[model samples]
Target: MKKVGTMLGNIAMYFGVFYALLYLLRSTYNFEVTLSFAKFLSRNQAMFMAVLFTLITLVYLLIFRIKGWIWPHADNNLFRVAGFRRLSAPRVWLMVGMGLAGSLFSIGLIVIDDIAQLFPSVPALVDDLIKGDSAVYVIMGAGILGPTFEELLFRGLLFRELRKVMPVYVALVLQAAAYAYFQPSMALSVISIGSGIIYGSLYLRTRSLWAPILVQITAMSTIFLLKYAGFYAWYDKLNEGVLYFITAVCLMALIGGSIYVWRTSDQGHDWIRVAKARMADTPSAAPKGG
Candidate 1:
């Protein structure tokens, strides 16, 4: 039933975003201009949908910004997840380094995918999309706003909600798989799932959303900037020798970072315990006095 509710929430979120786009289309643009823009985007259907999706999702995020906070705390009057919680600057920076390490790991997956021809090329698709006037829209829409909203939904809501009824590990795995499966290609799926785990682990450790949000923005904005600047061509031209070395470096970083996260943090020890405590505790009850 909890899963069902989550499914509904996911559906409603997308629908809300879609409706906002429809409303904007009807109100913000005259029919003739709208027709012309549609025709223009029709030149690249993939980018048209991507831009439209991002804009709609951004509008949805703006509308429910307050409500989004409310849900995290809805578990108890004490939402330690993000709203009322924060990490120290030093701790946040530690996670930043770890998350970037993970980002390198994800990028390495793409590089390998390119070599193996394992999936459709996202860079090529973005190249098709990021032309002329749409560049700014794609950058802001897909690069920045899109990722923030995903974290809001996946990290902020779904993971916390799952923590209520299930074990922390269970919630993490399920959420990670869902995140990966929703992405465009198998290669990206692998990368997304890997990122989802890192993000989920960070949230659990710090009980703060900002850490993962920062990491996501860093990874996504870098990729978007690269695409915008036509840097993927240089990436494409890189010899297999360089690709192998970078992939090995990324793998080592990922392994080392995961070790650091596990051994150096109490979050791993607290993972299941925290969920159990929160799950057993109820909103109607008073928060325990420390």
Candidate 2:
């Protein structure tokens, strides 16, 4: 169908163009430019790439916006927090909380695997991306830049477009699949797809990119920091009893948070405000309002 082809083509183009631009910038900084630039890049590959890629992606997004590309506007309702805000606020805190909870949930899956070995080990590429990278680079890339671009494209633009034609759940699956496809390894791909489902659902309910962005940033940063701090190493050394207990606690938090959101989301916009709005919309409450 034309719809499927358009979606796939859009995915391919986004990645293709992004990588092409990144490669071009990197190649220029490495070879086409001065020797000092090349040395700097060679020395701080990951961090430098994150900064550059994030910068370029932002610029590309700007250009697309100016040109009226097939994308959602960042100034719209979904992007109220587009530019990181100056004031420390409650919504920001909420995003951090949701992000932390979501991260714990996803990593719980891996901890479960460590105990059971039911899943295959992470792919070599995924392992390299995870364990081999230095702290500064990993934190910048995975924590900040990665979350920014990914949320912008997937939940911000792509999902918006898909929802126009298909059901929200269907769009969530399609975008999740797209998200998974871009990951390094099969294991990560699977995990990302699962995570995408949760994130997409949250986005649908919350209508704010910040919620999922925070979740993503926290998830990635926590995983990287834990790996750096040897938490996983310590986890591996734990006996089955402790492992099971930790795993269960994480599962509970994950599932509990998910259920709370599902049951209490009140049609998905501004949780603090949703409750009053929900009550006001009920027939009895409507009569009271009159």
Candidate 3:
């Protein structure tokens, strides 16, 4: 019974958040109640929702700590796990490069508007919601709130927990799939899922939640800027010809190459050391040398 309960708890920990999100969306957008809980949420309570979700994630982390379900560190270096010093220059640069690459890919899709057409429902929904004094709500939701909450939950909590139960690759792919399902636009869905995988891999490699958080925030901010500058719409009008294809390909290749180099270089080794050290500090974690 204890084993069954643990299994159920694990499943609920991951999928329950997702279920809550779906319920929030459906109740607000799909049904037509006079009070329109969805409108109310978008207008007045979006920040509350974001904070609530963040708190839920923190609670899960606390529970896991109490249960001794934490990862082991590499060398028993307490210094590596607790402070900003663990964040190295290479890791930061790698995250920035990855973020830029993701931004370029998303921009290419937007340029053709091929991405927007994938989710014909979203623009109308967005337009309707932004009609009143709530225009800033869209910006806050997408740019700040969504990235902060979603990354903390998915990359910070879910991926870390999943690593304890599954192989790293399997954990990353599953997280990415969840990210895709949550996206409102299909094109954005693909980008989100792909970026989720990248972020997951970085987290696994670096063992620092901060790395992925920075990347996610940067990517989201770039998207918001493009949208605000009208570059997204203007790109749609340009010819989606050979030049555009070449440019996209080249940009993607550069980004991928940068990530590859970073992962393969000495900086990657330092991050691995830091991760192992952090894992060692948890109560249930084995000693670094052991």
Candidate 4:
């Protein structure tokens, strides 16, 4: 029964957000325009959606809490899994490097598409969505709200619940896969999965939601700026021949550098050990001062 309820909760959360977004787009904008705008939203509006969705989910969670379906204090430990430890300089640098590498990997795909003349339709659609005065909407939706809510739900809550049913790696993979599927863009779907892995790994290592959230925010911000400045389109144009090859090499180098920094960092071992350890410790080491 508990498993069934939990499964239902997962399904509800995922489909609820999907339907909500679909409804928002359908009711708020023309299908063609909304489709086009989705790309921009992905780049810009994602954070907004994330924030809205997370808040709505929190409300639902609260409702469950009030009904005695779930207890806030009973599962308080799960919510506090994002241990509030400060990251060391080495870990910080390592995460930044990894984040850059992840960005490069995403860009490298675009370069490949350019070389093959297989550019995705999503960007053009996004471009269409922002064709007029509503451009600011896209910025707010993507830049701020989406990142915050997504981290809160996906990395923070969803994964925490999942850890109860599946192996850590399996749960991470499943959550990441689900997250990727929501994007509705093959490239982004792939990127989301990869990012899920990185973020999930970080969460597991540090037992801190902040680490993944920070990385996600940084990534989304970079994407927003890139799109706002036409860098995405520019790169799409350079997707062929020598430039693409050079870009790919650079991306690989970036990945290698990030891995090196992460492995050598002091917090790297700490995170790794924590991730491997059982979920025995609470958010803090001190006794619950009841």
Worst 10 residues of 2 by lDDT: 281-290
Q: Over the stretch 124-195, how does candidate 4's per-residue lDDT look in tens digits?
A: 434543443454555555544565566666777666656655566787898898778777567668657866
lDDT of 2: 0.60
Q: How much lDDT does each candidate structure score?
A: 0.61, 0.60, 0.56, 0.56
* Per-residue lDDT over 17-115 for candidate 1, one digit per residue giving the tens place of the 0 to 100 score: 666775675453457757877656655443455566567645645544555576654323223333325678876677567646544444554555554
Better of 1 and 4 by TM-score: 1
> For this target, which candidate reaches the highest lDDT against the unseen true structure?
1
TM-score of each: 0.70, 0.70, 0.66, 0.65
The ten-residue window of minimal lDDT in model 4 covers 281-290
Candidate 4 C-alpha error for residue 71, in Å: 2.8
**Residue runs of model 1 more than 4 Å from their true location after superposition:** 1-85, 98-116, 132-135, 229-238, 267-269, 284-290
Better of 1 and 2 by lDDT: 1
RMSD each, Å: 5.4, 7.8, 6.3, 6.2
How many clashes in each structure? Answer: 0, 2, 8, 16
